[model samples]
Target chain A: MSVQERKQRERAERERLIVATARELAEQQGWDAVTTRRLAERIEYSQPVLYSHFRGKREIIGAVALQGATELAGALRAATVTADGPRARVAALARAYLDFAARNPAVYDAIFQLDGGLAYAQEDTPEPLKGAFAALQESLGEVAGNGVHAGLFTETFWAALHGLATLTRARRLPPEYIEQRVELLVDRLALV
Target chain B: MSVQERKQRERAERERLIVATARELAEQQGWDAVTTRRLAERIEYSQPVLYSHFRGKREIIGAVALQGATELAGALRAATVTADGPRARVAALARAYLDFAARNPAVYDAIFQLDGGLAYAQEDTPEPLKGAFAALQESLGEVAGNGVHAGLFTETFWAALHGLATLTRARRLPPEYIEQRVELLVDRLALV
Candidate 1:
C-alpha cells in the first residue's frame, strides 16, 4: 500500500479498537466506569491519542451507539428473515429486539438511554440509527393496518418493546412472565 | 399540643421541606445538579440535617419517586374518572400518563430512570407504586380482552406508555405524532 494509504488504514484500525474497548469496558462495569483515562490505559494509548479520535466521552458514546445500531439492525433482519410469515416475522423481530436489549444492555443504553449526542428521526439522523428503525419498519409496515401510518405503527410497537426491555432489566416488571408478555404484545399489536 | 408532639410535628414538616427543595432543584436543573450540599443550601438547613432526613442522595431520590408515584396515581385517576366510556377512559389514562411524564420529567426519572433504591412489583413494593399500577388497572382491566391476566395486560399496556414517554422525552421519536401514537396504542392494544 502507498504510505498515505497505510496511515489511513492504521487510523481506521485504531478508531475501531477505541470503540471496541469502550464498549467492552461499559459492558463490564457501567457507562459511568467507561472514562477516558481508563480507556486510554486499557488501550495502552495516551490521553492525547484518545482525545485525537474523540472530543470527549460523549463522542465515544456516540460511536458506540452507532456501532450498536448497525448490529441491532442486522440482528433484527436476521431474526425476521428466518420466520415463516408476517406474524411470525413480527414476533421474531420483537424477541430479537428485546434479546438484543437484554444481552447488550450498556450498548442498548448508549443508543436509547444515554446522551450519545446522536440526532434521531430527523433529516440529519445518522444512517445506522435510521437503519435500525427501518429494520423494524420492514416487518411492521405490513401489519400497520389499513388507514394507519406504517412509521407511526412501528414507533408505537417499538416503544412497547422498549418498555418491556427496560422495565424487565430494571426489575420494575416481573421477569418470569416476559415470554407471555411478548406473546401478548405481538398478538394484540401486530395486525397479522 | 404537648412539647413532644410539637417536636415530632416540626420534624415531619422539616422532612417535607427537604423533599420539596430537592425535587424543585432537580426539576429546575436535572438530577445531576441535585447535590446534598445544594439541597441543604436550598432548604436552609445544614448538611447534617439533610443527611438525617435522607441517608444520601439515593434516599432523597426514593422520597421523590414515592411522592411522584402518588401524584401520578392521582392524575391518572382524575383523567379516567371524567371519561364517558371504557375506550375514552383508556385514552384519557394514556394521555394523562404521558402528560405527567412530560410535565414532571425529573420526578418521572426519579421513579423510573434513576437508581432510587426502590423495590417494584414485589410483596414489599411501596404502596404508592402499587397505587399507580392499580390506577392503570382500573380502566385497563376492562379492556384487557378475554383470558389474558388483567395484571399482565396492564403491565404490557403500561410498558407501551412508558416507552412512548421516555422515547419522546429523549427526543428519539417525532414529537408531533404523539397524539396519533397514543390513539394507535389504545385502539390496537385495548380490546374495548
Candidate 2:
C-alpha cells in the first residue's frame, strides 16, 4: 500500500511488457530480428528503460527462457495428470513437449537452442530450469526401469524428446509418422 | 592428362580448397565468423572465386554438411565393423556418432543445425546425407524388432542420438555418465 511498493509493482509490470513484446517480435520474426532498439520502439519506451529492465538481448533471452521453462513445466505436468497410466502419461508428456516446441519455436529455442546465458544442470541453475527438469523426472522416473538411475533415465528420455522436436522442426525428419515415433519411443524406453 | 582434363582437375581442387577453408574457419571461430570476404582471403582467392564454387554461405554450408555426412557414414561403418554383435555394433555406432559430433562440432552444426540449403528425408536429398542415414540403418535395422518398420526404427534411434549430441554440446546436460546413457539407450530401444 506504500508509495514505494506501488512504484515497484509498476516497474515489474513494465518489465513483463518488455518481455512479452520481445517474445511476440521473436515469434513473428525469428530471434535474429529481435534487437534492443526495435524492442524499445515496440514497447514505446526509451532504450534506457529497456536497458534498465534487461542488460541486453542476452538477458532478455534468458528472461524468455525462464518464462518458457516455467510454462513447459506446467504444460508437462498438466498433460501427465490427465493421462490414466504411466505409459499414457509418458506418451502425453512427449506429445505436450513436442507440441510446445512446434507451437512456440522461438521460445523453445530461447530455452534450449540459443545462448540465453543461463546455467543448467548445476547447483546454481535457475529455479525455472530445474523445475522443468523436475517435471519430466516426476513422470519419467517412475518408469526408469530396474537398476537405472531415475535422473539419468529422465535425462536420456528428455534428450530423445528434444531430438524429435528439433529434427521435426528443422525438417531433418519428416512430419509424417511422428505419432508412431512417439509410440515407439514410449513403448521401448519406458519400463512399464 | 590432356590440358582440358588438367584444367578440370585444377578447378575441382580449388573448390575443395574453398570448402576446406570455410570449414576450418568455422571450426575455429563459430559459423558466424565465416563470411565470403574472410573465406576468400583465407583461401588466397577473390570473392568471385569463392562464389564460383558455391552460390553463397548457404551453399557452402551444404557442401560442408555433405562432407560431414560422408565422414560420419565412414566413421559409423568403421566402428560397427569391428564390434562383436548387433548390440555391440549399435553401441559402437552410437559412440562413433557422438564422437564425430564432438570432434567436428561446426561440421555437425552444418549438417543438422544450420540452414544449409539442403533437402533432408526426401527423395531429392543429397547422396552423402542418404549414405549417412543408410549407414546407421545398416546396423540399426537388424534390431528394429518384429513388426516395426526398419526405417522408422532407425529414424527414432537417430533422433535419440541427435538429442544426446546436441544437449551435451550445448552443456544442457551434465558431462558425466554419457557412456551409461548410451548403453541404456541401446539396451532399451534396440530389441537385441
Write out the backbone clash pairs for model 2: none
In the range A1-192, model 2's lDDT, one tens digit per residue, is: 699999999999999999999999999999989988899999998889988888888999999999999999999999999999998899999999999999999999999999989999999999999999999999999899889999999999999999999999999999999999999999999999
A1-192 in candidate 1: lDDT tens per residue? 599999999999999999999999999999999988999999998888988998888999999999999999999999999999899999999999999999999999999999989899999999999999999999999989999999999999999999999998989999988999999999988887
Q: TM per model?
A: 0.96, 0.95
Best by DockQ: 1
Candidate 2: residue A93 lDDT (0-100): 96
**C-alpha local distance difference test of each model:** 0.95, 0.95
Stretches of candidate 2 exceeding 4 Å from the true structure: A1-7, A46-48, B1-8
What's the CA error at residue A182 for candidate 2, in Å?
Answer: 0.7
| Model 1 clashing residue pairs (backbone) | none
